[model samples]
Target: MSKSVRLLNGSSLCSGRLEVKSDQTWSSVCEADFDQQDAEVVCRELGCGPPSVLQGALYGEGEAPMWTKEFQCGGHESALLDCRSSDSDRNTCSSGRAAGLTCSDPVRLVGGASRCAGRLEMKLGEWTPVDGYRWTLETAAVICEHLNCGSAVSVGKRKEASRRSVWSIESDCIQSGSLLRECATPDHGDSILNLACSVPNCRWRC
Candidate 1:
């Protein structure tokens, strides 16, 4: 069974090839051994949203040892390590058969022309716009990265005519690598953050 889990080789923290630690050694999971329930547990373990995509070699075939076991997740486990596993008889797995996953971000851009361009908002208990009072490109880049947008092209502010509720994110907290949900506090502000993200491969865009 896995003791710990992490993702590797994807564009953002929430997406990548799945790797699990066992016996103090990292091992890559085979696609045939993974399922949606298993993927759900991994995303939850990492504090990410639901799995959006699951495929083989979506990132890259990892160099780590094959897990050689099939995970049986109940879809409600808090961590991947809580799941049960059974040994697989198959010894050899093919290259490009490693399980890869991408989880949706808890944040999004809305009221714009494209998914990657608009007002910044995040889902806590409910969706709310972000207060962009003192935002910078660096902080905005974090949102872009999590959303799988290429990078931050520009950051702007949208002023509402009256004060409204918004999520006030502590820039310092975000710069320190905390997730946006962890860094936000409820506040009433008029200025909402506006951002435009570059479209790289645009694989995620609809």
Candidate 2:
């Protein structure tokens, strides 16, 4: 069972390599099977808002017995230990590629019905796609700001079908205040990422 959790090597408490304390020692979780859903639990466990950003091995890995138990959290678990898990026994997904997390801030917007709502396309020169998962107040705030949407109390996630491939982003955004165009993002060179955002009041005028 995971007893405690914390972020390591990140510039701030809101980001870093995912590590869990169990049996009195610190260990890293497997990153291959991890995603935004799993990341939501980490931020919530740390009292941070929804996960705004994610990166694999962004902190340069870790030493460990390597946690093989895959975590299943609904993005609301008070503690990481309370979430369910089972042994996966992975080898390719090791500590050298530990996971990294960042809270949301001003994000890139591509397509949607309103200025505030649409599919996220962060790559600078061209548009790309992103994944949809549980979002928190903080994360939603960033997206709204990027789109000039009023400060909304809540945000909802929607799904879509895009023929494009997922953007291959392997780095954490440099700053919370900075949006996608400012960052160095490489294209997956395929299709849209598929995550959608919807906000209230600021309907698309154009």
Candidate 3:
């Protein structure tokens, strides 16, 4: 058993059927109302990464004692247990529907004046900096999208590189990928990216 919620019989540490421990018993989570929001919470709980896919019971049907509680996470929650709302009643769960998820590496921005603007950072075994090159409004577009801030209003390139910038990005990022981690490249470089985002209710996820 893991110290916290874990994916049972998963292909990797970050992918598998969602499971939870209650009353000292491990049970599968019912797929009812499960969506990207729910998966994000699960990934956060496991410290894995952002969600990639939500396959309904594709991994396999779980055994008895299904957890029917509906977990409503706001994407920023640290754990599923910390979701804003949930129910513990198993009677609401139906049979033949379990939840599964696939997650990739996670990405974040830091060192900026605000959450929406900063040097791009990524998590791949550790936190590291991402080089700022060929950046454009498109780049800001994707970033703002993640922050749920509609789209980028402006991009302010920093004159000096941020401190401890050791990684550089070298990919054809054109505001396409859902998570910034989807971008390619594996080299290190020193560059600073100062950005600004605008959207309704953007402050919530920023």
Best by TM-score: 1
In candidate 2, position 127 carries an lDDT of 42
Off by over 4 Å in 2: 1-3, 91-95, 104-206
Model 3, position 177: C-alpha lDDT score = 46
Tens digits of lDDT, candidate 2, 1-206: 12498887775566788888888888787676567778887776665556866887777777755776778776677787788776655656743567777754324555655555555655333444654443455655555554556553544444445334444433245326433434434433423333334454534432
- How accurate locally is residue 141 in candidate 3, as Cα lDDT from 0 to 100? 77
lDDT of 1 by residue, 29-76 (tens): 999989999999998788777899999999998779998888999999
Error of 2 at 61 (Å): 1.2
| Residue lDDT tens for model 3, 1-206 | 24547776565566788887767787788777577887887887666677877886777776747776677878877777677656555576655578888765466657766676666667766887666667777766766665555767776555554355445544344344423444545664545556666655743554
Models sorted by lDDT, best on top? 1, 3, 2
Which segments of model 3 are wrong by more than 4 Å? 86-92, 107-206
Worst 10 residues of 3 by lDDT: 170-179
Stretches of model 1 off by over 4 angstroms after superposition: 1-3, 87-89, 109-119, 124-128, 134-190, 194-206
What's model 3's overall lDDT? 0.66
How far off is model 3, as Cα RMSD? 8.0
Please give the lDDT score for candidate 2.
0.59
> Clashing pairs in model 1?
none
